[model samples]
Target: MSNIGICEYVIGVIHDKDIWYYVGRYDANGMKLKPNEQYSSFLVDAKRYNDEDILREELESLPKTLTYKILELQRCPKCTKEFTEHPALSREDNETEICPECGVKEAIQAYINS
Candidate 1:
């Protein structure tokens, strides 16, 4: 059998006159749609599409009151914590953010080992 790549789907809705979007991933089997309770219009019945471009087009076709933003987060490998803030200057990659707590812990451990 040929290997198939996982597809990402975006969910969006209009609430209190504002637009919000959430990104989710899925495979050939099925998708997991867990909408945030805080969002006013939780998109429980939103459809999942494989192509991001097509999803963007569909979202844009919605009413003018609706808007969408792609959600992306990079997590730290050590702490397994997701962060929206940019990584420190010492970090080589912009996508990954080593949380401050993890950074301090690693620094102290390195110093002790040295």
Candidate 2:
């Protein structure tokens, strides 16, 4: 079975010299069997700041120039893992409660069964 997926994006912006620049983004994808529920993935842009400390340092360096906010957070039903995006989950209706890794296993099992 094919599963459709949905995603939500949280954009991070920094105001420098009155110009707002997009520094990064967080993408959250819906989970299988729970289309409405979304989770955050570790995947992020902002190559200059890969770690939270670095990101914070850069933000703090600019003081009033930097600001950020999280739109939401979601948890994986199968693994209980929290993420900004669950790209591996399925948003299709009547889907099973399986994460991306487990979903791959399920596909293999189906292939073998067939």
Candidate 3:
């Protein structure tokens, strides 16, 4: 897996809360989760590692099938919130992408500071 690049999206199930979520654009190291983060079950599809939009679209349509119990998971790394709109790159780093809301907030802050 190290040979492959980092995965931008991953499917994880929190058994205790019965919640399923997808972490987006998280490159703490690789496709693997942080040490503190725990999930009853999780999936890392090497094929979908870099396919952010495609993976989300496929996961969205998965509920229609019988394979997935539920598909309510999406979190922005910066805000840790579910973002409906397209992601925005953080101005702070330019490389770190975040949710639209956070992006707006950052822009506003930058404008105010300037």
Candidate 4:
């Protein structure tokens, strides 16, 4: 690759607004990076690799579905326990997964754990 390509690299999600985006060096195929990587609010389209135009073209593409699960504390109707970050999802305006069974489990576990 070129010097710019080796110095700068980006990672992004398939769909949904990225909560976390990462960017950093590619390690030069045989080097190591220090201090890990950096996070950015704006993400680069992963489809763009080697050719920025391809990524730019892919920017119009959207994933069929997208969802996010957050663990939050809640009292389970069954277990009556609250867990840390137990998810209590409600679909977002953009089709994000708002609630999930894992959230219920985590909430109950958190409640029990506490």
Candidate 5:
């Protein structure tokens, strides 16, 4: 299987043709090499093999921007209540949790009467 998400690549072999190259494969999980999971590739030569050393470097970087995505969305201006990712509010008749700051007071009043 191919590597998904972030993973490690293994240097399975080396090809010394006209161009010097280091071949390797992506390891699924962080573990000692196993026979079946191994694959092959042409990375950099001996001089730039340190490129593989940076494998774990990405983990040191800052996290994703998703937190800003969720936080940046506008909440209700009147009530300051953040809009959740849940389904939209149902008809007033079917629900009782009204946003007192923004709900139509007359509509809620009529529903309360009937």
Candidate 6:
């Protein structure tokens, strides 16, 4: 049997310490959250994708602005902190991806050991 599903767009705002706050979602008519509906205390708790390609394609189609960079929020597996910066490869494994801060720390540790 096949499963049915619905897809929607979401918006988030960066908050303290790079934490992302889920602001709202878009419906068939348009984006659902209005000015008064905005909030910043909540974290995004839902997985919003099944197909990565489709997700990227849809997000890329949205209009860009001079004020903001369009990107996906990601969590660094090493520190469990959220980040929007490009990840650096873990020196310990050279395979695991980590946040930029952790990468710098790793480099420093390596230098100390040498």
lDDT of each: 0.49, 0.40, 0.52, 0.36, 0.32, 0.55
Q: Between the candidate structures 2 and 4, which one is better when assessed by TM-score?
A: 2
RMSD of 2: 15.4
Count of backbone clashes for each model? 0, 10, 0, 14, 2, 0
Candidate 1: residue 75 Cα off by (Å): 2.6
> Across residues 1-114, which tens digit of lDDT does each residue of candidate 4 receive?
123212222334323444533333334354444523433344331112444444444434423243322212233333333222224553223232223564555567668978
lDDT of 3 by residue, 8-78 (tens): 44454444554444444334466655523423233342122346677667567543332323232235677
What stretches of model 3 exceed 4 Å from their correct place?
1-74
lDDT of 5 by residue, 3-53 (tens): 222223322222243222222233335454443323223222111222444
TM-score of 1: 0.35
Best by TM-score: 6
Tens digits of lDDT, candidate 6, 1-114: 122222333344344445343343553357675633443444444224546576556456534431122344566777877554678999989998788999999999999999
Off by over 4 Å in 2: 1-72, 87-93
lDDT score of residue 36 within candidate 2: 17
lDDT of 1 by residue, 1-114 (tens): 121233446455545565544434332356543444323333333345667788777666545654555433335565665433344422334454476677777667768988
TM-score list, all predictions: 0.35, 0.28, 0.37, 0.20, 0.18, 0.47
Cα lDDT of model 2 by residue, 62-111, tens digit = 43534553322234555654334343544334464446665566667668
The candidate with the higher lDDT, 3 or 5, is: 3
**Could you arrange the candidates by lDDT from highest to lowest?**
6, 3, 1, 2, 4, 5
Clashes of 3: 0
Candidate 1 regions exceeding 4 Å error are 1-50, 83-85, 88-96, 99-114
Candidate number achieving the greatest lDDT relative to the actual structure: 6
Cα miss at 12, model 3 (Å)?
A: 20
Q: Where does candidate 6 have its weakest 10-residue lDDT segment?
A: 1-10
